[model samples]
Target: MSLRIAAAPPLIVPVEDLLRETGAAADEADIMRRILAEYRTTLLGDRHPLAEFRYRHMARKVVGVGSVGTRAWVILLTGRDDDDPLLQAKEAQESVLERFLEPSAHASHGERLVRGQRLMQASSDIFLGWQSIVWVDGRRRDFYLRQLQDGKGGLDPDVMTARGAALYARACGETLARAHSRSGDRVEIAGYLGSSSAFDDAITSFAEAYAEQNQRDFDALTAALDSGRLPRVPRTVEE
Candidate 1:
């Protein structure tokens, strides 16, 4: 029997105060709007592929823990063709993770996200780029732009059965090993790992530890929400 169930609405999390603490000044929303307008003109160009698409509207939203609280906007672009999506995402930036890990960081935030995503992902979306904007304070900050959600699919572990999880874990392991092999010198890595069994055990240990940490972080967030520490504002939703 097919069960008809209504999906619960997404829980909105506010991180604007967090952004301000991280280095973004007040009035970040206005700054983001101005930045996106310039991006469409400069980076995208007048006669670009998506130029013909009509922009229905844009809205501000919070996303990602690493870059949480920073300004982000998801633009809805509609095209005459049903298959084409005119959606675009614009994110404000601070220091990138690469800057902490490596001495040489990209000049722009968009470049960092694009380069890192390329390095980690098997494949990436086509429209990804960086842009810089000088705010009213006369300080220039970097922002990255990309398609919101193009051909995105993923399974949630919360709903997965044990059998499903095991199968998914095996598939993930195979995928990771394949990705590592594609990057070259797999024989050396394999030798260092000293048989697949040891490597698998190490990965499993790390995954379990990380999962615990994730639970702790989730609990902290829940506490914060209950205490009303996060910013609460009326938000407009779009589908």
Candidate 2:
């Protein structure tokens, strides 16, 4: 079955205005194009249809809470006629998991993210690639590029029935299992899980505790903001 594209609110800012707001220099666009050109040649190949596409515009993309405070931008490229493609180039930093485990072997964090995504997913975006560039501020940053929301879908939990929610959960579990099986020892994992509810119950308990902890963290942050112990910046995004 084919997947549906997820619906999202518009997040466009004028190209020049975005650059100005972000403190990019006048020649930043040219620098970005050079980076894209290198990516096109190395990863996508010069024969790819997108290789001939010319850079058009770009904007600052407001990402979700998980990627909050990270630099993200959407680039527009056009080929012949009205053919346009939107690609997101998001900054990739050292993964949070690295704090607990060994550091990644991949030199570039962007490449690390792209490789992990390609390995875990059944299919990935055709434009999936990574590049590193030194910004106008002289800071080198790593970024992975992907076609924006290509064949992506999302389910709304608020509108789901009990049966639908269960089905969704099952689907999610299956997907996670498939991904893990691809990268891990399936036999070992199966032996550990073994036809028992013990593992499931343990996971349920962990999830419940995690949710309670999340709520407590949120309450603590709210209290701190209200008490002026933490500075609260108003959101500039319009509803």
Candidate 3:
């Protein structure tokens, strides 16, 4: 059976307080409304579930790891009495991977991410879409929108036992296989990966050795820091 994620509890940020606080200096809530208006006929049609939901309010939002200092907002709309649906609109920037690789197909980085996720995953959020807004500085900014699901769970690999680790590895491998199959020729891939315990064993050996080397490197780095060879940089990434 598939898991059913619970809907998030309603967030009641009074519209009056929001507009008053954000009076004239960089209002993301107003920006969200403007962006959503363009998609009224396209995505949120007359018969859609969120069709009747108006953009009633907005609040500044902080996104997760590696995306620090990004401009983001949580938009809320109340339908009828207590029905409040929240959507997150996060600023999109060029992928660090793109710095080493070719540029994205979509001009907007947000659409590029959304398109890639759609191809790689079995399913995606229904509200997944992207738009560009002109900032006060005149430069345009791209943003992707989606509802934040309440049931999303995170992993803790350090706490897992041997059996749990093995299960997680198997599941992760299967997921990667599925994504590869969708993006490439499944028949050719199956043939290449065919009846192969040899390939699996080799890959497992390589991964374990690499992980051991990583541990050694980390230990060396700690020693260097203790000896004052390298100065620590600012917090560049967080998890």
Number of the top TM-score candidate = 2
lDDT of each: 0.64, 0.81, 0.74
Please report, as a residue range, the 10-residue window in candidate 2 with the lowest summed lDDT: 1-10
lDDT of 1 at 96: 47
Candidate 2: tens digits of C-alpha lDDT, residues 183-216: 7889999999999899999988998899899999
The C-alpha stretches of model 2 lying farther than 4 A from their native spots are 1-26, 41-46, 211-239
Our tally of clashes for model 3 stands at: 0
Q: Which runs in model 1 stand beyond 4 Å of their true positions?
A: 1-48, 54-57, 64-66, 81-86, 92-101, 156-159, 178-188, 212-239
- Write the residue-wise lDDT of candidate 3 on 1-239 in tens digits: 33322453223444345556546466656665677876443343356666667777666654557678787777777777655658887898999898899998888888887777778889877677778878655689898888855856657988999999899889889999899988889999888878969889899899999999999999999999889899754332223
TM-score of 1: 0.58
Model 3 regions more than 4 Å off: 1-30, 39-46, 81-83, 97-102, 154-159, 213-239
Worst lDDT 10-window in candidate 1: 4-13
